[model samples]
Target: MAIYELRTYNVIVGKMSEVVSHYKNEGWPALAKHPQKLVGYFTGDVGAINELIHVWKFDDDADRRAFWAGVYGDAEFMAFAAKIRPLIAQQQNKLMLSAPWGPQP
Candidate 1:
């Protein structure tokens, strides 16, 4: 089964653009290099003040675990995260296994 790593970040009003831009400009490059990351980005939406959602696909649970362990321990990633910390209000995560009932192929 294909697993999806979902992160939803709530950012301060009027700062979502900044949050988005920061991820694109600085964060994405480093994340793109990660072997387990299939896709990552932020998208605007309702029900939240502002949203930064990232979806990462992995081959298996071990792959995902290794990737996150390294990501959380990386100095550069930590720095990048710090840069955006003050701009965000909260963050949530969901780890899901894809289902056939989801959107059509």
Candidate 2:
């Protein structure tokens, strides 16, 4: 079964705009150099403000680990991460599997 990694980053209050700018200008560009694994990215407008969420799908745990290792090890991506790290207050990650019967994406 495919595994989905959900990453939620809580932006430091008042820093969401700057963080988004960096992600758009540098982060996504660097990540796009790697294999396609991203599902999409989301941000909140109502409750849970300042949260940046993105999901990625992988074949299994090894695939997931390998994908991250590649991204984390990349010089360009690391540069973007370094710039954005201080703007994030916290991050939460969860691995999920699709339900037995339902739409899968």
Candidate 3:
């Protein structure tokens, strides 16, 4: 089964656009190049108050780990993360797999 990672960041009001753009240009491309990650998307909602949601699809847990290990250790990724740290209040994430269907080929 394919897995998806969902992360929510509580971004400071004025920084949402900036943070989103940064992710669009840097993080998104970096993740897409990973061997396991298939795609990623971001969403913003007023209901959550300056919230940013990101969804990432991966082949499996091992693949997810490998991709993250590389991204986390890279100097450029580290710098980008640092740049957004102050603009965020807190973040939470969950890893989920697509639900299987009852009758389908």
Candidate 4:
């Protein structure tokens, strides 16, 4: 079964657009080279402001670790991360497993 990761980025006030733009233009494309699967990307519409949420799926913990290790060492992704670091106020992630009876993606 695939393991899912829910990643949320809390951006500095009024800097959400910049972060989204950078991800749309550079980050996502670069990450696509890896084996992980992107489920979706979303921005806050209500509740919290300046927040971005994205989901990814991997075969397992080892797959997730290997993919991220590559991303961390990738010069292009590293540069992209540097550019967006100042825009992010906080970040959070959770790993999830699907229930057997639940809807599958």
Candidate 5:
């Protein structure tokens, strides 16, 4: 069974566009170099404003940690993070397990 991670980024006011553009243009590509699996990416439509949400899956906690290690070590990813980090005000992450009776991806 895979573990799912829901990550949310709350951006500073008026900086959502820069964050989204950087992720779309550079972050996603950099992440793809690793073995991590991205389920989806979305922008908040209601409630929380200037928020971005993305879901990822991993075989286990070790797999998740390894994936992050690779990401952090990648020069491209490091540069991308340097650019986007200032745009984000806060971040939230939740680990989830799929219900046995639910449909699996």
Candidate 6:
């Protein structure tokens, strides 16, 4: 069965702008070179402020591992990551499997 990974990063209160700009200019561009596993990226509007959330789909756990391995091996991505990391206050990740009756991402 396929799997999905949900990543949530809580940005430092005033660093959202910095994080956003960096992701726009550097992070996304670096990540674009890898296999396109991303489903989408989102930011909170009302209740969940200062959070950056992204979803990704993979064929299996091994595929997910390989995908991240490729991403981590990229120098540009790692550089972007170094810039972004300090701005993130906390992060949460979850792996999920689709329910049988639902429309899938």
User: Please, what is the TM-score per model?
Assistant: 0.80, 0.98, 0.78, 0.92, 0.92, 0.98
Descending-lDDT candidate ranking: 6, 2, 5, 4, 1, 3
lDDT of 4 by residue, 1-105 (tens): 789999999999989889989998989888877765789889988897788998988898998888889988988888889999999999999999998996887
Please give the range of 10 consecutive residues that has the lowest summed lDDT in model 6. Answer: 96-105
lDDT of 1: 0.78
What C-alpha lDDT values do all the predictions have? 0.78, 0.96, 0.75, 0.89, 0.91, 0.96
- Winner on TM-score between 1 and 5 is 5
**Tens digits of per-residue lDDT for model 2, 20-104:** 9999999999999999999999997799889999999999999999999999999999999999999999999999999999899
Question: Candidate 3: where are CA atoms >4 Å away?
Answer: 24-26, 29-33, 36-38, 102-105
Q: Which model is ahead, 2 or 5, in terms of lDDT? A: 2
- Lowest lDDT sum, 10 consecutive residues, model 4, at 28-37
Task: Provide the clashing-pair count of each candidate structure.
Answer: 0, 0, 0, 0, 0, 0
Candidate 3, 1-79: lDDT as tens digits: 6678888898987888898888878766665565645444556655875887777777788878887898887776777
TM-score of 2: 0.98
Comparison by TM-score, 1 against 4, better one: 4
Pick by lDDT: 1 or 6, better one: 6
Runs in model 6 deviating more than 4 A are none
Per-residue lDDT for 46 in model 4? 85
Give model 6's clash tally. Answer: 0
